[model samples]
Target: MTDTKYRKKLLMALLAAVLMAAMLCGCAGDSGDGETSASSLDGEADAGNRDNAEETDQNMELAGSEIGREFTERDRDSSYTESEAVQIELEGNSISADGRGVSVSGNTVTISEEGTYVVSGHLNDGQILVDASDSAKIQIVLKNAEIYCGTSAAIYIREADKVFLTLAEGSRNVLGGGAEYTDTDENTVDGAIFSKADLTLNGAGSLEINAEYKHGIVSKDDLVITGGSITVNAVSQCLSGKDSVKIADGVFVLNSEGKGIKAENTDDSTLGNIYIAGGKFTIRTEDDSLHASGSIVIDGGDLIVESGDDACHADADVVINEGTVLVNSCYEGLEGYRVVINGGTVDITASDDAINAAAPKNASDTGNQDRTSRQEGEMQPGGEALQNSDMPDEKESLDGEPQNGELSQNGKLLQAEELPGRELPQAGGMPEGELSEDGEMPAAGGRRGGQMPGGGDTGRGSIENDSNAYIKITGGELTVTAGGDGLDSNGSLFLSGGTVCINGTASQGDSVLDYNGIAEVTGGVLMASGSSGMAQGFSSSSSQCSILRVLDESQEAGSTVTLSDSAGKTFLSWSPAVQYSCVVLTSPELKLGETYTLSAGSENLEITLDSIAVSNKTGGMIQNMP
Candidate 1:
């Protein structure tokens, strides 16, 4: 039989194994033809089955207290720059902002003016409130200060153009907030340190914030943290900035219930950006560890994260320039409409896909153009396999033959497909603009459609549906352990250089590396192991690679696999965490006409690069690259 025919059979067999596994797990059952029932796709269970309950319980107990494998410390000398010092000595129950327009009432000190204020001393059940001129620039220097607020923010900036919270060199300080808060006039605060204006946190000292209620620190505008030794423990979110969050340099340990850090501004698409130039972040959270609405750009940082949901998520785009990221646990490791990895060392463990490039189904399809292009009917003749026994989820749909440009599952414009159920009259006008190279509608396209995840009302969502979504790996070292799919993209996938390793033998609905559109490997080392059902190979390749299928008894998890040339030169080696029936390998040294022997534990096979497949044959459901 031809390699293509053999591969097709293997794919079918792998699907059979996956269906059995799912049934055994009591999560799902196979459709008659060995595919997941379409009815169960909408509300598919995402809960991962832990290998051991005792280990999981123990891990949950130490989730917040212990982070990443290595404990990190900060460089003290780089904390602050030399500046002017203004003293505001704290005495007993009384406090002062000194001659800078301030008044002390009992344990609380309110600043009605703006200026540089250096504070020292301890206060019980008190706070510092800054209510100044709208255009004023305020600065507070904390020097050996300890503050505890019973029912309000420890430091509240009710009104200010911008505020700078600085830590004095060599000093240690603590700020604590009560479990509940009392509203101040018409204002409502939700953080231990709350600010309604632009805020900058910088200094050399070690500072800690304890939030028993909402968040550790929150800024309504931009929040920038440059330097300090900061620790935060919050019942809700650790840090939040409504407009933007920028972290340059700091050492942060965050423990939170809701999220570790959030930058959400649905009111303005250009506002909710997250930029990290340099920092050390050790985070544990019940929700997403890092989330943003606009975009997340990490230039440099060290992130050790544990999250209940996605570890890193961005509605628009996620760009990793240089960083060391270790996601210990998560539902999904990394998610974005556009995921671009330029350079980084990333390791992830997840219950779902480790690296996903997905977007809302029709994020880019707006206007009647999406409605008019489809065939008017229920499901087509050959779509019996796509029918569902159960009612579909409440998806946003137009009642008609789609006229507005309809985006396909592969990020392309649909040609002639039927509606799932019913069809009728056409409504709406023409689509606004053309799709950009990045899968985004041009600026002229504007907003028109419905909501697209990330809790945003803006019609602009995943670029994947807009023809701009994809995974581009120019450089990086990414290792993933997934309970579901490994590296998956809704659109095209391009890898020019990098090393990618997948631990999961995706026996589910996807593959070790799944793509809706084309997948190309021009140069790089790609190693994959998975069930043969969806062990997809690249569409085209210029690099040396190998594709192998083995008996189930021949491959086992933790068994070392090695490949060597005829001259006994080692080329590739790996040890997978889970057993797999298929293995794909690639490297720069495996030249054509050179005989190479591959060993998986005790079994061995010999083949030449010319005889092996460097590029994969296109089949299944994915579309070819245009």
Candidate 2:
């Protein structure tokens, strides 16, 4: 018998074994034609074998968006019969292929037909160029192939309906590019693997790519990776999908001087998005680890990122449904016009804001396009100083409260006349007093006017400039340690459920919870600690109880801060990683007209909750509260 027939029999034998195993499990049965019946698997289980828990408990349904579910049937298929496959072999600089649509000239091999092509052996300095008809679909199986091009991509797909590059099972493949591009074609090719058509990679093998000049892999259309072990090291972007990049399942290790993975199509908002359903990614880059011009959605993945700039940045919105995101180091952890974390485990250590929601800027106004060449600490192009319109009025207060109707500590409204000796900080001037020995400003007896150290205001209610921007954390365990603001929203902040712990900036200009609009927490456990100079707590409109306390002295890092009810049952506890003088906490368990004990290192205080939002920064406020 032929080798092809022998392999066909082996495949049938494996299918039979799988069908027998399914029958034994009572989940499926064979149809007597060497095939498992799909309907058999859908039958109701016997009472004795039924699971105690609902099936939904084991397999949680994906969100309504169902993002990145466009992979076609052919994109996920990697099987090929030996009889129908064209075999191409490369030995050093020599190549041999007798296929009808394959043309070889010197060391370059070109494919012009749609069929399964198995490529193997080593090419010293050659290219596998695919120039098929626009409607043709091609599949190239790399069976332990090694290819390198001196001045262009080793694998270039100029035209095709779609291409599937499958790494043959158990085989290892490598594609490398030189330091320069000598191609003068109309289409610029600048990656080890450049595809002008839609590209899909799926298989059970491994592929390593090295790009010395530009990107490791560039797809002009959509780029989809369903399976494979891919390692890419590039000078610019490790992976660049102009339209969209969707990864269903893969093992990726990417390192680049520029962006690790990015979608660059800015013309259409829906086209320039990234969606990762399942993957294991370790990315280190100088620019954003994952950037999209539109939106970025992480449904399921394990991403470990160390970036010189933002770890995950999107010009539109960024939504994390379910994933494990560990940003070991970054300039900003996650930034977008709208940032929403529904269900995930996110831990970020950043030099700037950990979670920031700012208005989207124009492409030219944003400096991230050429960030690799920009100098650190230098102002970006089109940067401008803060204008008076950007700051709130000096007389305004937080949460849109009128100047004369500011809510006092015990939920009683305080009139302007009630604060006789109160003084508002002047524009570009400090309060008329010297700093205390502990570097704290003396209490002004009542709430100070909304004013920053500079001419800008601390911002009251919704910021007029970026009113549409917001940050919403519905469900997640998010922990952040930052040198700047922890959770910053230029517009508003909404926390409905989850656990948020922030060890924020020690600098006086930043705060742990900074928002221009209302910061409302209906249900959640929040513990934030940072400098007291510009600290802002949850708005009085929140349903859950909250407290903002400014300590007389800064607490050292590693000091335990605990909050417990009158019965001494601890509900919230955290140890900050930086020295902090301000602490804010909110939880559903904290009720009105209840007493709680707050322990900060060596100091302890009993706080009586008289209102939904409590603050100790107002002097003589506790004495006046009935």
Candidate 3:
């Protein structure tokens, strides 16, 4: 008999033994054919028996080989027969099959009804393909076996009920296109491990997944990395999921050209949630290191992110209650809606405003409306006298009573006493001091006098000018080094408390500095010093010209006139209030390097000077000399 016929009989014998074992467990008997009816078993017996049988079957699937033994063997020289059954062992072992067509090297390795399986091992340089045309399940227990794919993934489960790839403590799985020199236009398969099921990584293990085009681990369901060291280096997003990718506790390092870990959902209602309760994660990417379209809550973990863009980005809120997050980015460090720093120290420095709040729209219009509404509410209908009913009669008469009932003549009814004494006379109306024609005040040498209105007496009028603005140093220490007015405010400057030191020059080097605001000293101390000698220390240019005059007689005395320009150049000098006889030195008009002589009643004064500063209007000194 041929080898194919011999293996066919052996497989049939193994199946017969398995069928007998199933029947002894109260399963339905098989009809001489390979078909068995599960409906004939007792209802409760069927459910309980199937559960126990499958559990026992999975455990006893591979029972024979020891470490470093061949898990299965297949005939590479002959055609496959129906009775050829590949035997798989549970111990550390390897498998070998045909290189071109479908080959099996396991006890009960089922495949998808219409799919192909490409299995490769690491210890050998050969690959095998197994094709199954019926719906079946395959469970693989890798122990001390090294699997490598030449140009495809190590294990490909196209369409199967389930595919289990387990790596023992000392086993490895490597998948990469073999080192070649051709740059052809052929599809090169990458990615170490690829699965289409809910992937779970448990036990103390290490998974190093490196891909050129795709990600390290691609799954359709949730990818849960419970406890393992998973290092994924991919061109695309490192670890992504259609639903969510959770890292409960593990050492996950992701280096990707795209986002390190992206959790997004197409549907808004089924948004993904990236919850990192505990893990040691380090992510470095060219884009946002950690991006989540949904919410990202880092309750506790060690996440270190370095990216070219925002470190941690989320479409919704990102709450960081407790964790040591060190982020260094070229752009904004942390950006989100209503960013609340309840705890933790976040040191951020940007080229622009470090921390900014969005400004309110229509700010000017809102402020104007608020002011107008406040003023309208404080309005009163009548004057003060009309509102006070308890005012005495003498007080009422003093205001301007209707007395001596002669109708008070024609135009004299409203006398001076009818108005307040603080009211000044109008320009073209009756002058309160001296009246002239057309009820106006007379000019200096114009009309003399006119009788006072209401036969009231007129006295000599007096005018006092008390219009000087000042700046008061209130609370707090304010040091001002400004180009213009040191401290200026339109309203009253009440310096309740604080110290203000102002070091400001009026012009370039001119000593005459001006303070355009009211400087009041209610509490704090103010130390102000001008540049040099340009007259007024601090002066106001307003109509109420407030000025703090610094009179230095020690510098300006006996001035057989000492004059210094803005460049500190001493120009011309002469004596003022002197009886001149020969030449009167009236305003020297000295130029650069020019000297002049003045004779006052036989006493000659000789003055020598250098470059005169025309910009500063500096001439000569005036003094009472012989």
lDDT by residue (tens digit), candidate 2, 507-589: 54457876554577799889998876456677666788788776655788989999999798999999999987778899889
Off by over 4 Å in 2: 1-67, 363-465, 618-626
Ranking by TM-score: 2, 1, 3
Candidate 3 per-residue lDDT, tens place, 519-586, comes to 22223333333222221221111111111212111212122433333355654344322111111111
Report lDDT (CA) for all predictions.
Answer: 0.60, 0.70, 0.33
- The TM-scores of all predictions, comma-separated, are 0.70, 0.76, 0.35
Q: Backbone clashes per model, in order?
A: 17, 1, 22
- lDDT for 296 in candidate 1 is 76
Greater TM-score among 2 and 3 belongs to: 2
What is the C-alpha local distance difference test score of candidate 3?
0.33
- Please tell me which predicted candidate would have the highest TM-score against the true structure: 2
Q: Which ten residues in a row have the lowest lDDT in candidate 3?
A: 617-626
Write down the TM-score for model 3.
0.35
